[model samples]
Target: MAVRVDLNLSLDGIAMPANQTAENPMGEDWGRLVAAYVGTKTMRERVLRDTTGEGTTGVDDRYAAAYFDGVGAEIMGAAMFGLHSFPDDPDWRGWWGEEPPFGYPVLVLTHQQRRTIDFANGTRFEFLSVSPQEALDQALRLAGGADVRIGGGVGTVRDFLTAGLVDRLHVAVSPIVLGQGTSLWDDLRSFDLGYAVTSELSEAGVNHVTFAR
Candidate 1:
């Protein structure tokens, strides 16, 4: 049987704003958004910080922690992995500190292969310059019966969901709006994607909703 799992968190209409910086007009208020969504949880660990600088007020921190708590392996996009084109600078680590939040093995989807990056914190980033199916296979192998998580930049998540790979999804809809930026629902064709509400909470300005597919 397929591994039962949960992928949690939300974005503005499923799209990453054009510029993710805090100063970017398109950037969402990270602190309020994070708190409103992922609230206090025992296993909560803050993995990705809003490069927008609302780290202390992170709304997604709780969810990221809870989600990571449930997964054994992670698959992320090249951009989200911090190797957009190429990391020519060895001094340039990802958006995270020396030890990234994803302490487990993280498989990054890329077109150009690169060497593995091993941090002292037991976190390792392996470049998977292969198709999504190949990457998923590798992730499952690394999972060793544990659940696999498809980390996102929207496109990656949509791809897996459309292929019926995602078992569940959690989204925290923040109240703020971005007049223009990348939209989460951009080219997704409609299909019978059904989700049952698992839970709901309100904080800051947004509503946090959990859906089981």
Candidate 2:
């Protein structure tokens, strides 16, 4: 099974915005960075659970549709799971509501251990404090031979990449530039050493880049 990473970032490689606060968790810059991806019909149908069929179609939607294909399990950092925003709030399930888009197991990498949360549509969240390899091992078991996705907020993806655990990485680079924020490529110099790079510009003005090893 392939270890994949699909993410959207600013032109400057910023995965998270600098002005993030409790008032604006995603921050103002997040919208611009992920506009193309969120505007797709696939995202609308899956993440938003919108059955209205009222979103963009074509290249962007194609990539958005491929995001969830064959992904049996997901591994994400605590921040991505909304733990950073509500550290003490035990009731905070995640950014996704009752029925999360991921219809599989989710391993939340966090220092603070919590009981496993099972949601509707077979989405299970298991908080764990383990190394990247260990986390992947658990995810693989939960994946049932399907691919393990490295869902991210920058730090987690970088950790897996540094550990040489990722096999396929797809990055959608938006046109906007967030001058300061969490960067995905900070310590990832020569990260594409063993991967073959491919790029394509979509109609939404986002660059669809993929690194496959």
Candidate 3:
């Protein structure tokens, strides 16, 4: 089965989560920018509680690693891949420093033309100007049934979900709250997607909710 997972943070009472990312792990401030999307305090509470401390025993990095262990490829939007424009004068790689999070072949959806970026850890960034379907098809072909992760900045996940391409999801709802920003479901006209909770964990204020579609 094909699967695409999306994750985010938000305020309580809302349906989706917010988008909040600090400059870096240990940056200027403790926590500064707050990009709101959706979700509720209750939801955020659940997600944060599951990603830290003892709750991370069988969760977090281990769980995520296992999920992508033998995975074929990954599909990520260009915006999520980097913060600057492609084909620039200096050519910035990404915000993930040297080693990236994903080690598989990641197809980046972008309109700008650029050559593929190969990292030392075996993750190659292939830019694609085609549609979501095309990128997904390519991912599935390389996935070999393991699992194709739809790493996103929100819009990419919605595209796959609306097209009925996601089969399973592991959403990490954070504890922070952003009063206003882009929402995961803001443009969604319907919520017909059904998901059964497979597993749940609460630790360090992050709730990890795994769902099977």
Candidate 4:
């Protein structure tokens, strides 16, 4: 099975906002970076679970739809799972409400041990303190022959990339620039040298870039 990473980052390669507070979990820069993806009709239907058919339907929507394709299981960091800001809040589910978009199993990587959470939908979250390889092994087992997606908050993606565990990676580079934030390419110099790279400019102005090995 293929291990893929799909992410949205600023023009400066910042994946997460520098100042993320409880009031603004994704931070102020998050809106600008993911505006295009969030505005797509596919995101509205899938993530928002809206049947209103109220969103843009074009190149941006096509990329947004592709994001969820072939993804049977997901592995994400605690921050991506919304545990960084609300560590003590046991009732905190995640940024996504009751019914999350990811209908597949999700493995959350965290230092602290916690019980597994299963939603009414097919979304099952299991917390693990293991290394990237260990977590990927568990995720692969649950993936059911489909590809496992590396859903990230920057650090998680970097860890997988550094360990050479990712086979395909797609990054939507927004036109905005975040002067300060957690960067995805911090120590990843020449990381794309071995991968076949391609880029396409979406109608919303974001560059849809992909790296496949």
In order, what lDDT does every prediction score?
A: 0.61, 0.92, 0.61, 0.90
* Candidate No. with top lDDT: 2
Which whole-number lDDT from 0 to 100 does residue 81 have in model 4? 91
Clashes of each: 8, 0, 25, 0
Against the true structure, candidate 2 reaches a TM-score of: 0.97
Q: Write the per-residue lDDT of candidate 3 for residues 156-183, one digit (tens) a residue.
A: 7878877777777666655665555455
lDDT of 1 by residue, 7-53 (tens): 32344563455456535432563344344444543223354343434
In model 4, the clashing pairs are none
Q: Highest TM-score, which number?
A: 2
By descending TM-score, how would the candidates be arranged? 2, 4, 1, 3
TM-score (C-alpha) between model 1 and the true structure = 0.73
lDDT of 2 by residue, 99-210 (tens): 9989899999999979899987999999999999999999999999999999987889999999999999999998898998888899889998889999999998899999
- Supply candidate 2's per-residue lDDT for 100: 90
Question: What's model 4's overall lDDT?
Answer: 0.90
Residue 122 C-alpha lDDT in model 3: 77
Candidate 3 regions off by >4 Å? 12-62, 83-90, 187-193
lDDT of 2: 0.92
Q: Candidate 2: RMSD over Cα atoms?
A: 1.0
